[model samples]
Target: MDTTTNALRWVFLFLMHHPDIQDRMCTEIEGVVRRDMIPMLEDRSKLPFCEAVCFEVMRLGKGSPHTAPHTMKQDTEINGCVIPKGVPVVFNLNSINSDPEIFPDPSTFNPDRFLTGDGRLQGTEKMATSSMGRRSCMGESLAMMELFLFVMALVQRYKIKIEP
Candidate 1:
């Protein structure tokens, strides 16, 4: 493969293998879901643990890492950095999502941090980081619902094993 293609492939694998995020995902799913009970869309809102896991996953995944870019329509300053008018800019999702200040122990995937002791999201307040806004992933809701159903069905109907 060409260098560009090879580079893309490596990046894909790196995201897939990100240990802190990936392991927490598996652990959360394995904990709340039993080997029975088919997960449904109706069940999503009730699945606090599952939702938390999804949030943390998205935070770490930083969906489409380098895909979204925007342009400055007018000269602007953000976080003390100034941008010239009409300048192109890219938002590196990973950096924002994984900021240690915004997310305590950002590198560690801890879904509980997104939740309360009663097992609800810390708040219902919407933020761009909540996957809302012009830059939001259009398919976020559909993809999340699909993933929950798919994983639940697989675990209920079959035994999955990881080989050493």
Candidate 2:
């Protein structure tokens, strides 16, 4: 179905599988935001661990590997290969998501990757979920905001786990 909805499902599944992560995210939510206050976009930065969880979910649950086709504006050399102008290009989200060079042990659902040594939110804006730059998904921010709020609210209210 929808890619954002798919990723959201993955997030809950991951949390169900990893109670430690869910607890940590809940702790972050509990410690940072007031119980009566609804989590907002501004609160996102205050909860780095939660953001990390979201980033990790986005990284692993990329529903569509290849993006919409785009044509190169000019000759572009990437790494070593050269792409001529007018050539079509489609970024593979899976490739970037699983690239060992960028994410060590890429297959693991390690939210810590988005955190720094002291446990602060790092540069997760570079995640492949929305691609990058002008060509990125127009609703990326809205999607992320929805995801952040959802995960925060859900974890705070419920103990996610396997039913069986």
Candidate 3:
């Protein structure tokens, strides 16, 4: 629940801070979904910009700063460093999420970064928000659906504003 709530709060904060982005999201939502009805899961694929905004928010927000602790099953070498068996390892999601190679000017809030030239929402494997392997987040799909519905509904109903 914390993860979902935090994600929502961060997205809303980003939208409030960037009215241009917020307006773009609203426009995108209005185009795909009728204002008289709430957005449905089926509408997710049509809202590329809105999906990008959600992805951008998750990437920049550091929803899961570190993945669950992992232990080495056997001795291994990574980049010339020996990792002995039974050693615990923690993956830092922030480093990957902010990597300049994958996300240029990563500190900047740019939803277009998650979009292709043809305007499609790109995958977020590089962000590494969810744990890998058997420990991966089981609610990933649910979380995404909730994000789309909640964000779409909110943007469609009202314009977000940041009070100074």
Could you estimate the TM-score for every candidate?
0.66, 0.91, 0.94
> Which digits, one per residue and each the tens of the lDDT, describe model 1 over residues 121-152?
76323212324456666665666665556544
- In model 2, where is the ten-residue run with the lowest total lDDT? 123-132
Quote the lDDT for 105 in model 1: 84
- The local distance difference test score of each candidate is 0.56, 0.85, 0.85
Question: Candidate 2, TM-score vs. the true structure?
Answer: 0.91
Where is model 2 more than 4 Å wrong at Cα?
Answer: none
Q: How accurate is candidate 2 locally (lDDT)?
A: 0.85
User: Cα lDDT of model 1 overall?
Assistant: 0.56
Error of 1 at 159 (Å): 5.3
Winning model by TM-score? 3
Candidate 2 clashing pairs?
none
Candidate 2 lDDT for residue 108: 93
Model 3 lDDT at residue 69: 87
- Which whole-number lDDT from 0 to 100 does residue 143 have in model 3? 81
Task: Give candidate 3 regions above 4 Å deviation.
Answer: none
